[model samples]
Target chain A: MAIATDARPQRTTTVPRRKRVRRTKGQKAFAVFNYAMFAIFALICAYPFYYLIINSVSANNLSALGDVRFWPIGFHLSNYGQVFQLQGLTLATAVSVARTVLGTAGTVLVSAFLGFMFTQERMWGRAFWYRFTVITMYFSAGLIPVFLIIKGLGLTNNFWVYVIPYLVQPFNIILVKTFVESMPRSLQEAAEIDGANILQVFFRVYLPNMTPILATVAIFSAVAQWNMFQDTLIYITDQSLYTLQYLLYMFINQANSLATAAQNAAGGSLSSIASAATSQTSTSIQMTVAVVVVLPIIFIYPLFQRFFVKGIMLGAVKG
Target chain B: MTTQAVLQEAASSNLVREQENTLKRGSRKRVGGKPNGKKSIGMFLCILPFLVLIFVFSYLPLYGWIFSLYDYQPALGLQGSAFVGFQWFEMLVSSPTQMAQILQVLANTLAMSFLGIATSILPLIFAVFLNEVKAPWFRNIVQTLTTLPNFISWVLVYMIAFSLFSSSGLVNSVLTDSGIITTPVKFLDSGDHVWITMLLWSLWKGLGWGAIIYLAAITGIDPALYESARIDGAGRFQLMRFITIPQLMPTYVVLLMLSVANLLNNGMDQYYVFQNAFNMQHIQVLDLYVYNVGLTGNNLSLATAIGMLKSLISVILLLTVNLIAKRARGTSII
Candidate 1:
């Protein structure tokens, strides 16, 4: 009589017993082969990072000779100390971090706003405006014209060049639009019926549902902003506006000039032994700088990984 | 008889419209006066800034194509520059050597793009095999590691390449120490197999990231298909061969179409970073060539002319692909 009151008995009573299926030898063999292949491939993908990390930590002489592979030989933090003292690196890192944060926030908000607006059929001339926006996705004005525009706009050597010129990206808009369209109509309607205006409905009802797509768009923007050097290469000659990637690029290009750069950065008072140590090969400087450039990406990558696959799926499903 | 019937229909519809208008006006008053009109105008105002921005950025640049029709002088400015006909276009093909150089660049662009298309199938195969792995955690780890390369800049990739494959780098050191070869290989410095080297480098950077769409598509495949195959004594490989590749074909085809539309655009970043005096002859794609001609060579007009042709051809190709897609798939990407 008390059986009806039991809470945990529903599944056992209604459902069939599950059966275990034994795997064939062929399946087992394939599984082993697959796992082995995955191990090797993963190792291949991760090895360059490992190599750079090991060499950056190891002593200059052995690493510069390429003898520090497979393991770190002489562990030291001197390279980090030396790298930080390079002029403009601190400023560049700050600039890069600022651009990444500001640029991502600006782009995500713009994309979300436009995406939500494009979905509103009641908006005046929505179709024409939507097409006008989306058509920019197909083509681009070539390098010279783009450069001329930026120069005309006085973005050259300006910090805002990193932010302003890319504010209205069509591809991001399309992704956001597609994601917003996939959301249930009832949610927006419910909010609107409860006396919410358009912006209120957007911020309250839609923005909360927009986290995954926004995360994806944020990743796209952040990575593009963080990894951006071409703009810096062309627009900004001012050392104060140099980005971390651009500074790293300068290091890689003039690896042999590191001693001069370090000495000059230190105001030419570097002692003999330190100067001698700083005369390490281009490989050491290159690897160490490469580590600095890649460290931010590596640090934030795991946090973004969970959302990327889901985000990518949402984008692809729009197709 | 036809006129009378049409007039009757119109009269009835006009009456219905009048009632609906009254209902709408009542609701408008309830909502504090002309809500839809005000709301629509508000929305338009919100997007107006974006429209102006896109116009200035995207459409405004078309005006620069006129520079190719002018004798560009840096100090004179675009306005003060002398107007010329299509002299640059004529000069582009006027000489045999100039024509030959352009041809070679085009050839390199086509070769690289073809190689890219050929390797586009690798991601599909990768995704197929990757899906067969049952452990979600293991699959995720492999995916995260593999996708790491795509997130980094091409400069970083080149740095990694230098560290791993430079003359005194690890590979050569290992090879020479083992006495497999007496000398270190000129992997990065040599001009040999430049296309293949570039392709491999791109694959290293893009393979796992490229597999993402196919993997997503694979997850969307029906589970019943696999269950039925299992019941029918079909093995895993058979099921994959029959279902997986075919199911992924639409996505693959769409990507391929987009790539084809972008045939001339072999992106310059990887090639630019990897360029050396040794590989410069083979590595100079159209974009890089245009850049060199404009800034380094100081032939901005000629560069603009070439870039103009490239943009025109690309837009035409995209339209062609859109038409084909519409015909075949009943939907166009554009």
Candidate 2:
């Protein structure tokens, strides 16, 4: 829907060119200025990632001295290799990937199912249950109380803490429901008329048609699950359960001790891989971990950006 | 949030009408015969697990609110602890020190939220100008880059901040080497302009993403409005001033109200990651205060009380905003 509308304006713009108003110098200048400003702003937004990436790959002392500005100096993957060498780094990365996959899968599946189910009037107490679930969006149980509930449920140190509690996300359901409603109902009816039950109709007809909205939900869930650090901060005390993002959080905040401990864990052998002038320092390690944490989002968001624009438009209109 | 979209959808009678239309169309065509009891039950069974999960995570957690009524010793457990029945609430106002601390935190939260609300127009302006850009490719690249930061975690944001502003960081080195200052400026660590700094960081992250909704609103405006205005010889600026801003005003107003309703919920993650001893006094907002008091300070009951109040007050504000929106715009925000 959003892409179609976006395309309309582009189509409209071309028609104005055939008219008698030849391109004026003032308009040309304004366009140039606007394009330049946007380019500068884009650079500002992107430079930090470039800066971090360059510094992470740069010689350690040069990076720490801040001499690697604008570009990498004595570039190498030693920091990245050493970042993985930090004790618990592998475990945290595994935990982060596992939770992101499981959490996003659970959220998308349930949201899609609930979204489809809500449209089925045959479900018992459909409206009541729909509102009951959606109303949770309006309020929260508060941080401490929710923490206690997680504790009481014995999920405080459990990996499922990352997945289960977030599975029934209300907004994704609404997005799917709205998207499904917007779709033509003929296919769904055909399936139903072919003697398919609600479950079969949902999976075969509605689910396939709902792909765009589901992709949007998947991106939201994945980014959230990947970036979430607070739940780990509060709920999980187990070392093995530390998420990669949380581990990065600790490394950044704790500054000296935890990172050097990681360095020590990397120990003399990994340090021996580099000369003294370019050995991986704490700052380089922090940057490397940050790059690691952000790379997935940087790659994933752009691919689904168009789909989410549609999702956001659906949400904005509904709002 | 993903949930905010759902919350908006919840109040939409559009879904109900659409479902009704589909149902009536179906029955009229005999596409689906009246679903048997078995089929209906099977449909219900499919969603039954989700209903249970919602109850457990959403409703069951409310039972933990009872801890606010007690001293809430984790070691002794809730049953063993003495019921304090609003004592924590009383202490929130009764003790001078606690009152001062709570006031400071509340002040920080409101200050940041107001700053946020104040700059809410940035996105609208951005979208307006962005729409003027005839180059679609440039627009997408700019949008993609600017929106990138919003998707990253705040901890990663802190990493960016640290890399740019730490004593040995790039910004400081650039400035000091150029003899702009004798000493490197303490950009991240300083307590001064903390609210403004936090607001700027948030804007840097959210401005482009926020503009997306307005951009959608902009697109929804009838192209005929622009065509007619162009035929009238209205300049680009004039068309924008007359048509674009006016069309976007309602969306801007509604979002502003929603932001106002969320005044107490300056989420803690950014504050948490940025906090240091130097900035602790100024940076502690309500949500951060709740986290610190509960987990770090180990005063779970007090934190629970504060959290409960924040939730209650936020819900009240939302309803109030909805009422005001209904009166002003003839539509409820909820």
Candidate 3:
């Protein structure tokens, strides 16, 4: 019988022995505490969305809403119906969808292409160009100047306002650069050996292998475009071009105004009070709109969850 | 320099030489003395669009900051406007009301940023505890749910606040129905405790997302250390204290330093959405104030001046932080 001599450290041998040992009383208590804490945290994280869904379907009566906690009371869909019927809803939704699809695709392609170019060692003035891009990460010429530039470009009210300004994101480019650097150089070397041009190598070899990171950046860009209201708040003055987020923001303002008006009329004429009470339903409609806005992200997030986590880790570790 | 520093420098220089050698070999294989000019031009063309974009969007903004030195009237344009060197900056310090507002905004910005930095360690602790969970499925579920809020926009978050914390919202309704309070609390409207409220909301939105890097770092920790610790009769808590915490320290410190460097860059979105007349005094941070003063008040020069000051200060902060990091860790981020 040959005695097997393992070259591994004592730690490796001890790992299995340690796992076989029974947990102590302290360990048991700690596990219980850990479970309880995580459960509470998870509940806190998830309850708001659950509550919104519950309350959106809850009865429209203020008193009925007051009783809603864990479940919908006197279930109703009228609030969503009212939200769907709101002015500019269709136009805003169309703009939002278009921006998310186009903006994400455009940003992903541009950033990845630039990223691949930056990784080529023999490229002229590569260091200077790299520094030029990276330094923008820290310094910016403030909001007003950027706004002026956009105005000068006549993109203030243009739909491309959503697409053009965001075409080259420095942070995403850096992420893609690091990712491309991490890929086996032999893959590109082999392609070059086979007489593939730079674009062909990028599209055929690099991009196919970059699906995870590309998807991650695409999701990030999509979520950003969908949620962006500031561009509309600053650049776009036309109501027809308003994104969904801006529309929701306006609705929130309208709801607040209606609520204040109702409170002011509480001690006044009966007819005025009645009309104010009717407008108070705007609060419920606001909740319904919130649900609508958040639903897409909530549904799509799970699909890309693994890729995002990996992408973030890759970026952080290298960054 | 210490021996360790000298050794690291030599090692890095050796690595650079090796990389250069490989590049030379690659270039020799491609062409003779010079690089393949055609390929180099092709690469340049590939990156030209990005270069142009960076110039148009980013560098152009710095040039546009020249408007600060002039009274930039939109109708008159920068060319026709009168050049007023440091006029807005002078006015920022000279005018009593404007100076007071600047001071107030500065206070709000620093206060919120400091609170954020103070609580930055919460994510580290959160990740550590989260990693202690044994059930993979449960851990995944908790993480998925917690990270969901990070994807949601500030606008939607404010809407959630309205639905849950407004006067007739769920929380107040519950509190009143249970006879816990005679009056509904104005959580969203009241300016009192605004900093703490904002901090809480920030924590709610970012805790899980922020913990992700730490969690990843935790995964990278060698299990052999834990095994050895266990064999050494170290309990779970002791193992965590002695091994896990120490391993995560460098990552936490670097992130903390970065946060300190970015102390002035609290973006305006969250505050902008949450702002009301009641809370505006406490909520209007530097960036939001820039927008309000510039666009709403139509004081373009003043806003540009303020924005330029902010950028200069931020760059200074970044350099100073980089220096500190270099001194403390023998490495610098930038």
Candidate 4:
């Protein structure tokens, strides 16, 4: 199982390669048209997000009329302030931070251990373990079955509800196994010769070498857990235990909450709160939520951005 | 450095092994006869957390699949629930409404997924071209901007769409200003456009992220291949066709395999986020349907039965594709 591919970066094979031949007049026109078309399409695909930021801070007129565009007419941080007051943005932020840390740590530990154990050459019943994990990968017991199981196990309404069910992601296991199996056998042999047992070799020699892959996996797992909304919706009936995404979900779905937001912002005008509540329900709020939720990942991504390309190429090429 | 030294080394190894046997017995006695006991204990301790979580969440919930056989009530727990042995599944098949909905959902899911795959091809082609552009700054900027959509949530994507396509949104304003149509098109409500919208948006969000793997594959390809092709008077198109595409084929095959395997996964988050009652009929994929039935409708048992059926079909489809690849192309996913 410990097939080490790490040392051998596949040597490049030479092939009959393509050349960038000069375009004929007609072909050049076609190329220009293609570039124009794709550029327009990319801009169209990206404009809404640009529009979102512009709309979020524009005057109420622009947002209510959906007229927000390339720039804001005037800056008004009212919406952001409203969201903060309505939800106590800091509380939700704290909850998200806590959940991300706890959940990512839990997932990395479980998936890494399972991956390590699964890749062990001398471990008995290797086929059974592989089949077992892979079966779940292909054939899940469905969401309801999972829900019922959680309920059956009395995991519902607990913070562990978020942390437990997804503790061992099968794909991450595969990724970790790919990395683990690629470790050089000489490390293990050297450790064994030094009187280190299997556990000692895995922990002391193997685990330390896996830091880069583990960090990358942790980033993926953390983003997933931090953005987990639907699970909290299902497993957590109590408001107190809801994750950040669920809170955003509530803001988006619940009109009263929006009204409450307006009321809380205005400090006593029930009618203005009521009037602005439904009318001000622009797409901007949704974008605001998207911006906030994704901001952490965007900021964090650059640190490990290089690893993603490496990880995917490795996983795909090896497979 | 000599043969006698090697012989002496071998002799010492044998002598050390003999002494080690006595030490092993003494150590076993020291640790109550459990040879390798410390290692095993450490191994168990290392694996303990994972075992507890998986058992409670994965293996333990497996028993709840029994609800597919029972007219289950959550309040009653497993014991008090009525066991009806495939009755739920039988009902799923026998009822035309249920069966038709499931089939339609499957078809819609497949169509949307196919549309997504189709949309991705153009992006792949575009990315390759983008790579060929001489300006490094422009290429890097485009690449960075393209992945922006990947970071955004489904909910936000839908909002962006809603503003663009809604009755009073920008598109309607343009159509009215141009005097092309008398009234707003009700784009979100238009059944004809719902599937297209879903496919388009999914592609938009996924295009850059999707192209990333292909780009890596293309880049990792040996440039010498292209150089030789140039020497042979091959045109750009010919080079891409023969060299680049062939080089990228393995990545493409694996990507296609994954796309095929998860064909039914028409992203509930995106669909649900974008859905309105008006468009639900057109956009309701199997995942959304299951969510509505099981959780929203509170027919927990029925949802499980439906989920079970879908999972079975998906597994079958995945295996079939894998087997076909194995037999014909020798590039199985497994």
Best by DockQ: 2
| Top-TM-score candidate index | 2
Interface RMSD for each of the candidates: 12.4, 3.4, 8.6, 11.7
**Residue B316 in candidate 2 has what lDDT?**
95
Tens-place lDDT digits, model 2, residues B228-304: 77768787788889988888787777777778888898889999999998898899999999999999999999999
For A215-258, candidate 2 gives per-residue lDDT tens digits of 87888788889999999999988999999989988887777786
Model 2 segments more than 4 A misplaced: A1-29, A184-189, A266-273, B1-39
- By lDDT, the best candidate is 2
How close is every model to the real structure, measured as TM-score? 0.88, 0.93, 0.88, 0.82
Candidate no. 3 TM-score? 0.88
Q: What tens-digit string does per-residue lDDT give for candidate 4 at B1-334?
A: 1111111222222223324444664544432123443334444455566656666665665666778888877788778989889888888779999778777887888888787666546545765666555445555555666666765566656556666777766677668768999788888766777778777777677676666666666766776677767678776667768887777666555556556766776657877776777778878888888888888898888888888777778788889877886786654555
Candidate 3 regions off by >4 Å?
A1-16, A19-22, A62-65, A189-195, A256-280, B1-39
Candidate number with the higher lDDT (1 or 3):
3
**Global CA lDDT computed for model 1:** 0.77
Candidate 4: tens digits of C-alpha lDDT, residues A146-197: 8877776788888777776778876677667767766776787788879997
Rank candidates by DockQ, best first: 2, 3, 1, 4
**CAPRI-style class, candidate 1:** acceptable
DockQ score of each predicted structure, in the order shown:
0.33, 0.53, 0.36, 0.27
**Worst 10 contiguous positions by lDDT, candidate 3 chain B:** B1-10
